[model samples]
Structure formats: C-alpha cells, structure tokens
Target: MASGTSVSPNANRTRSGNTLLVWSLLVVAANLRPALTGVGPLLDRVQAELALTPAVAGLLTTLPLVAFAVVSPVVPRLAARWGPERLLGGALVVLAVGVAVRWVPAAIALFGGTVLIGAGIAVGNVLLPSLIKRDFPTRVGLLTSAYAAVMGGVAAVASGVAVPISRAVPGGWHTALGCWIVLALTAIVLWLPQLRTPRPRSEAVHTRRLPWGSALAWAVTAFMGLQSLGFYVVVTWLPQVFRDSGVTAGDAGWLLFLFQAVAVATGLVMPTMLRRARDQRAVAMLSSAVSLVGYLGLVAAPGWALLWSVVLGLGGGACLVLALAFLSLRAEDAIAAGALSAMAQSIGYLVAAAGPVAFGLLHTVSSGWQAPIMLMCVAAAGQVVVATVAGRGTVRPTRP
Candidate 1:
C-alpha cells in the first residue's frame, strides 16, 4: 500500500521561489551555530567580567549541550503540534530574543540567555534534517553539504571576529555576543514565507517505539556523542590551550577560527565522500585516526598548536557530518528519521555535555593540558569503536 505523505505542491513555485527557499535554508543554517560558537572566543572576557571560576566558565559551553539533551526529546511532539515550518520560525524568533537577552550586563542574564539559545538551536538541529528529508528528499547529500558548510563557515566567522567586535562595540563581549541577533532576525524574516507554504493533512501519528537495544542504534548514538564531545571540547578549550602556550589572545581566537574554517570544507565534502564508499567503516576509522593523531600532536607539542588544530578540525568535521548523515541514511522514513534523530541527539548530547566540564576539572586538578588531551584521545578511540558498527548498518524502516 502506498504511504500517506505531505508535500508542498508548489514547492518549486518559480525561479524566484526556488531562489528564496535556497536563501532561507542558508540563512537558517547560518543561524544554528553562531550563538553557541560566538561565546567560545569571548569566554575569557565573560569569565573575568563575571568573576567565574574555570569550572563555571566551562559551563558556558556545557549549558548548551545540556539544553540540547534536555530539549531534543520534546521536539518531535512539538513539531507535530506546531508543524515544522511554524516551529522553526518560532525557534528563530526565540533565538533572536535569546541573543538580545544577553545584552544586559548580568551573570543571570547571560546564563539565562544561553539556555534559551540552546533550546532554540536544539529545535533547529532536530528539524533541519527532517526538513531536508521532506523538501529535498532526492538531494539530501547536496543539501546536507550546503547546510553543514554554511553552519560551519558562519560559526568560524563568529569565532574569528568576536573579540574584535567586543572591543569595537560599546558593550564589549555583550555586544559581541548579541550581534548574532541580526543574523537570527534576518533568518526569521526569510523563513516567514515557509509558514505560508501549505502542508497536506494526514491522520494522527502514533509515537513509534525506538530501537533501544539494537547494536546499530547504540552505535549511531555513540558515534553522535563522541563526535559532539570532540567538537564541543575543542571549541571550548582550544583558544585557552593556545593562549597558555604563549600565543596572544587575538591569535588564539584566530587559531580557533582557523580550526572551524578548515572544518567547513570537510563538512561540505564528507557526504559526497560517504556516497562513494561501499561501507563507512574505513572512512570512520580514518576520521577517528586523524583526530587521535591530532590529539597526540597537541599533547606532545603545544607550540605547533595551529597545525594540530587544523588536523583536529578536519577529523571532527568529518565525524560530525557523517553522524548527521547517519540520521537520514539509517532511517527509511520521515517518522523513523525523527525518532532516530531524537534518540541519537537526546542521549548523545547528554554524553557530550560532559566533555568540556570534565576537561576543565581535569585541567584544574592536574594543573596541565596533558590529562585533558588524553581524555580527548580516549573519545577518538570510542568514536572508532562505535562508528565501525553504525557506519556499516543498513537502514531499518519503522512505522508508527
């Protein structure tokens, strides 16, 4: 029997509509990362201004992961009630407000704003793939590439210019952080048209039981966790690592920027690379191996941090892109994709939230970077173990 599916009959309204949709995708993708990555470069300034301890400073990064974990499970139900288009548009509006909320000079406001930002991004993270699965079903690879690239590229830009913007603007780090609101607001404006696009009505969807005990499911979830751990840890601490190694703060920010910049290219290309491979085990191992080498390099030589950052960037970028692809690739339908995504990210981000906090505590106790870098090495090994299985599994289609 044919399945009921909802699609926009006029999705390709005109040359103009197609162009607008593409622009809207890019802008929304661009909004997903900046609010989070923008804070990394400004962490030191925030810490000093707020008189926060190292552990507390680490929470700036950790809070978002926690929020992602906390909010991910609830997204599917919300999407069902509100529709993906309305939910996404609402998320952008909330994101813009969250960015603006940070403009007030208070610690409570900062953390509150971060929580809101994380919640908003969490919605986008869950919906974007499902949206791609819906609107660009046949062009998943290309569209995913474009989405990931824009996200990484803009995040790199945010990391690069954060400090300078802080200095040049009236409110220092507050303004630097708040500047992301403009982009979010732009995305919301571009996204409004999507709200007008008609969706076909269908019967109520029963919540499908997720495969909790499946090895492939566990593998996908673990791979997602480990990749997220690597990226969040590096983004949170790489600037500090370079600064401690005698690189100036501005240069360190740029190094972190370079790290994310290199990642943009890899994120853009990994999907095409995956499509060519018979199985992803070799590619998965290679990704972990590169990251392991990069982590080892950071452990052995702090002075060559820039080169190591790029290597780590390439590896982390590949893992992230691959993990995201697995959400779509491992599921056979939109509902299954939503279930897999919710399971992978809800649990995955809870696992990931530990990376920065643990690293910070380890650094505090050991009084060195060695222990943290070793922990990152362990994470890379874990990624290899999980991805080997997840990367090889065939898709399992489920119905609600």
Candidate 2:
C-alpha cells in the first residue's frame, strides 16, 4: 500500500510536469509568427511614415528570414551546450528585447531589433521539433499539429488586429508592432520551469555532422525552403496585393487573417490525415497543387480574392505542418532531428529570405502583381516535384 501510494504521487507529478512542458511549447509557438505577421498588415503605414520605398519596405520582412538562415546552422551546437530548454528561454528574452527595441523611433533600431527577433525565433524553430522528438517521440504528429495550429491561430489574430490596434493606440504602427512584446514576456515566464530540467549529454554535442550528403536531406531542404518562401511572400505582401485590387486596408488585414485562420483549421486536421496515410507524398503533392491553384487564381482573377485566400490557407497550412513534421519524421532520432532541422532550415531560409525582396522587385519591374505571383506559382510547382521525393517513408541516415 505504501509503494502504491508513492507510485501514484510520482505518476501525478509526471503528468503535471508534462502538461507544463506542452503548454510552454505551445506558448513558444504562439510567439514565433505574431511579430512578423503583425508587420505585414502595417507595412504600408510603416513605409509611408519611414519614407521607405517598396523594395526597402520588403527588407523589413526579409531581414528576419535572413537572420533565420544565418542563425539556424549554429543552434544545434548551442542546444547541445546549454540544452534546448535553457537556450529557448534565452531566446524569448532576446525576442522580448527585440520587440521593445523595435518600438524605438529610429530606422536603425527597427532593423536591428528585427534581426534580434529573427535570431530568437530561429532558435525556437530549430529546437521545437528536436524537443518533441526527444520527449514525445510517439506523439510527434499530434504535437506538431498542436503547436502549428497555435502558431497559425495567433498569427491570424495578429494580422487581423494590427490595423485596429494601430488605430486605437496613440503610437500608431509602432504600438501595434511592439504590442507583441507582451507575448514574448509571457512565453519567457512560462518557460522558466523548463530551465530546471537537465542538459543534454556531451556526446550529443558531437553527434554526427549535419546530413549534408543525403539526397533525402536536400529534398527536405527544398520542401522547407519553397513552402517558407511562399508563406512569407504572401504574408509580407498579401495586404498590398488586396489593397491594390481595391480592397480597404482593414478588410485586407481581415483577408490575411482569413488565409491564416483557414491554415490553422487545416493544420489542426493534419494529424488525423497523417495517421491514415502510408507515406506523406500524396498529401504533400496535393497541398502544393492547391497552393499553385490559389496563386494562379489570384493572377487570373484578382477580383475573387476571398475564394483564393481560403484555397491558399488550406494549402499553406498543410504545407507548413508537413514541412515541420519532416524535420522529425525523416530523422532517425532526436539528435538526428536537430541535425536535419539545422541543415534544412539553414539552407532553406536562405532561399526563403530572397522571396519578399524578389517579389517586390518583380512588382516594380512589371508594374503589376501578375509577374510576382507567377513566381509563387513556379515555386509551388517546384514544391510539388520535391514534395514527392521528400515525403517517402525513408528516414535520413545519420552518418550521411
């Protein structure tokens, strides 16, 4: 009876600890996209107030992607040294500071703080999958879906409220942009408990080098890059695209909200679909194809923006969940997951970083949205080809 009583307390503590960990992870996910997405809806105001050109305004979005690419390669080593949990808590601090710094009334602060935000998000992006693989190996799909949904849901809210928040607040766009600091601070508090956990072993710090030579690794990299490129391009410019089509700014923000909201819904359903599938190839291909159709529809008929947003959301959400899942699904173990994730995101975000700038430049050269969106169409088609190869059941061999 004493043994039974003692075991019951231990079990309860385990459950309690696990619940806190999951909530912390979800809170971290919530912080990932809101800061970036909030900027999109306010880009026009930012551009006007700062006297920035379209190409330069695009850089505001591009800077973070660049940061993600640059910082991602080093995260695995840092995670190995400090542990993912402690490092993630540090990241939230950086993110909070970045958010606060961005609110300062200087162009340099704006750009610098954005870089800091990117650095912070980059760590979380690479570590979350590895943490899931390490702690909940069997529940990767479910947890990935959960976090992705929360990420998308918060992103949608951020987009929907940016303009309204700006209008309601005295500092206008700065206030809206900086308001996300609260979320970052909250994440930091929630994540404090995780710091008490043990660090990873020294051997993990020297785990096999990144899967640079693996064909499957490159395919996964391409999949991650292309989907990220598509998503960022839309988030950065979709409001402008809608405004150019004669939509009001507030409504444009809501449309962006709708796009992400649909994505959140789709992400929520992905786990069930993943469970029933033999391999993810068909799902990947179908999602890419749907996004292709959405992009093409925008080009052919900008008037039907509402329908296209829904379609893009459906495809984009699925693609995001799948790309993240691949970080875990393709790796053989948690350490391998971190290596593969670093490899994929390092090269992938470098590719994605160019998207917003290129889209803005294309729009400048063509004098319309067609050429810019067609570029996305090409990317989506490329995704279809790569997703086929990336979605196979083959796990990435660690030594390669």
- Per lDDT, the best of the predicted structures is 2
| Candidate 1 backbone overlaps, count | 0
RMSD of 1: 2.0
lDDT for 345 in candidate 1 is: 88
lDDT of 2 at 338: 85
Worst 10 residues of 1 by lDDT: 1-10
* Cα RMSDs, all models: 2.0, 4.6
Per-candidate clashes come to 0, 0
- C-alpha lDDT of all candidate models, in order: 0.83, 0.91
Indicate the TM-score of model 1: 0.95
lDDT of 1 by residue, 63-178 (tens): 98899999888887677666778888988888888888887889988988888898889888888877777666777777877888899999999999998999898999999988
